[model samples]
Target chain A: MNNELRIMQNIYYDNSATTKVDPKVLKAMLPYLENEFGNSGSVHSFGQRALAAVDEARDKVANFFGSEAQEIIFTSGATESNNLAIRGVVDNAIKGGQKVHIITSKIEHPAVLEVFKYLEKNNLVETDYVEVDENGVIKLDQLEKKIKENTVLVSIMYANNEVGSVQPIESVKKILKQVQNDRGEKGLPLYFHVDAVQAVNHLDCNVDMLGADLLSLSGHKIYGPKGIGALYVRKGVKLAPIVFGGHQEYNIRTGTLNVPGIVGLGVAIELVAKEKGPSKLKEKLVAELKNISDIKFNGDLENQLPNIINISFLNAEGESILMMLDMEGIAISTGSACSSGSLEPSHVLTAMGIKPQWSHGCIRISLGRFNSEAEVEPFITALKTTIEKLRKMAP
Target chain B: MKYTKKLLEHFQSPHNQGKIKNADGVGEVGNIKCGDIMKLYLKVGKNKKGDDIIKDIKFETLGCAAAIGATSMLTDLAKGKTFDEALNISKDDIVKALGGVPPIKHHCSVLAQDALKKAIASYKTRNS
Candidate 1:
């Protein structure tokens, strides 16, 4: 395709994968990338200016989460932030010779899920994966039943990356609080860690309100630059350092700051606070898609984030649909095994008890603030054509 | 996964797709669990030399680009070949004809080979 034609036809619906950088964020970051390049650790004037910028960015992020600036630790991205949050708490307990029991939901993003799996495989921690209902909402009762006296941390995502199911965070907070009160300091300290990467753009992330001891956020998911994210650790939470390096990010995460990315993230966070949710476009898209037959929508549509929609078209394989859409310059994602180059389909759908056949046919359409209503009809028209073609060829 | 332009072209516009009514033989391979299925229809006829040849071929596939493209390529290769020649059309040949598919998608071509073999075996059993 020619550049002009490609640009004219392109429509991106893969915001859950990553978002285009906001122009405002890019503008804010350019000065740091070009002129104000200095290590925040240095004591020179140039370093002082860089340090000031870092502090300002930290404050902006902290304010958005209703957390103290000191509580925020900047890391590479949500994957790193998740590692820091999950490993930091669990590792600290292990160092104290404590028998750690940790809990996480089955439908968590691999960033959080894999960390728990690694701990279990190494026998370093006893882990339990709380089940999710067919809608991919975590089972609160199962979570309550699985918490042991030694349960140190419970990691759950605020909104699932694939399905956009918003977990019952407030209820989870209440349950954890009651358990803590009942245990009354005799039991191991239990902290609630939330992977809020997908929720920051549309949900309230106040740390106190959510009762989150540690929370993870990604930059690129919120229209900020890639390779920069933040972890919020509450005032009294004690976490061991994951990386050893110069005293940076409260020494919890050690690396030279991604100065430009941090600046962009701060601006992006500020912008998202003012940005409207994609509910109107989501409603229009979903309603139009429902007219198609033999399709099942995944996730709890009533409780999900408005940005993401997951659906399975019976008989139409997801990779074929994705490829067909790609040919039309409409970008989307699929949960099919072929797309992942694995025999197993999407773990999220599998955990939700969706059959392999249905899971292989699933595709996720995630909207963003930049997506317009004008693009919706064209996307639906292309999708209808793609599904019809694939179904006609299906065996 | 990256697909060659040739493979993408075939996927976009597959050759001789859909079922042939009253086909001489029909075969289906792969399963829903593995997320790929290819069904091939064959019309076998006698050549001037009194040898069996594939007179017509068509396929319907529910799979990724590689599966669809490979099946399309298989039909092109087997359309006018003698029974022995069609039976010798291997997965490698299909892959080569499509430039190449990703290593993981090699199984898709394998499905195409299996479908053709099954169709020919069914046809021979019916005749005998």
Candidate 2:
């Protein structure tokens, strides 16, 4: 262990909450914060240089998502990106004389789910929150039934944070496929967006393959700095700008630009993506977690993100297990970083139909490049022991 | 896998846990979202002389073991003490009483402290 870690016990397995910024990505960002601090949109040589840097960073992110450079809009993170996409749709439909309807899943991160709620409350839009199965995936048939002529958008998360369940984007893609066909044309399109934050690292999301016209990604989740992310709005996708200002980001988004954060996000994306092979690593953790008595694995093991394993210990409460694990030098999360401080059960778990008893017992263990099998074996062992002890004593 | 002997003792034979349902003053806090609901009942006023001693203390926490453990310890230490005395009890006392917990588990102490203070505040709310 390094001196920095030696000063404190450091078993950081909570990549799902946020990741340690990659050294390479951070190193790449030093220049932007120092001498290269010119606005990307300016006209002078300094500005031109910074502008070139922004273009290169945009290209990197666009390439990562298999999208065109112009299609990507810089945002604060997935929350802002989700807000832009969903609300943009609602606002545009209102302007165009069409009533708005939206469809989303129950197990979405608050970013996506809350925007829908705001829209529904405003009366400008009506929403249908599709239910997730026991495994935390949406029923596509139910999604199909919810899709009315007024349904202007379907917003679902690319992955479930609490359970690590990967949604059937391809299946949802097929529905969008039929939507276009049955509507008789693709013009005046209804958008389909995925908050691809958790999936951005684990699942390969080529915009074409996923067939999503809009996708939101976060920098911090993929080993970049926080307060930065990007939105992928496919070419020909239309939504009026929410924040009015100068014609930045093709007049779709406004701001001087978060140059360093953008640069870091792009670099981090390049570094964290899996080269190949995932099932083995994830399966190993699942197998070990299952050996611990009273563990209930949330989400679809086969179809979920290989890096995330959410387990509920019937023997002990989730927070207790977390506390015990932290003392043992392991770091993880009970829910989204957004809701971690709350005493309530995670909305994501409850939406998966997990009972309160188990929900309170749940914690997400997300692995990253820094983790290893050696680290994992001990982790599972420690957790199992903790759960067993707590179970025997808890009334 | 077993919890530390110290932690188990706190859970099984928790010190100072009981309820005074007909408490002179009651305090409760509920997190509607987390579903970990806590209700604290306190029988306030003096034991015999007109001292500020707490008469009885109890808590019902629908949460994990540490929650139960911490709350149990809070009540164990607070009963029969003055209201001012009970309110002074910090999470440190609970952690010390249970022989220490992991730092992440520090939140449990926070919960216990909040529930305790709220219960005391509730008692004062009525007494005043």
Complex DockQ per candidate:
0.76, 0.19
- Residue-level lDDT tens digits of model 2 in B36-106: 55667777667676887777777766555566777878888887888777878888987888788656556
TM-scores of chain A across the candidates, in order, are 0.97, 0.93
lDDT of 1 by residue, B1-128 (tens): 68999999899999999999999999889854567889999998889999999999999998988889999999999999998999898888999999988998888888998999999988989989
Estimate the overall C-alpha local distance difference test score of candidate 2.
0.78
Model 2: per-residue Cα lDDT over A280-351, one tens digit each: 666787777777776788887777788888887763667666766776689987752212545557777877
Instruction: Give the lowest summed-lDDT range of ten residues in model 2 chain A.
Output: A335-344
> How good is model 1 by TM-score?
0.97
Candidate 1 segments whose C-alpha is farther than 4 A from its true place: A1-8
Chain B, TM-score, each prediction?
A: 0.96, 0.83
Give the CA lDDT, 0 to 100, for residue A143 in model 2.
Answer: 96
Q: For model 1, which pairs clash?
A: none
Each prediction's RMSD over C-alphas, in Å, is 1.8, 7.4
Docking class for candidate 1: medium
Model 2 compared with the native: what TM-score? 0.79
- In angstroms, the error of model 1 at A395 is 2.4
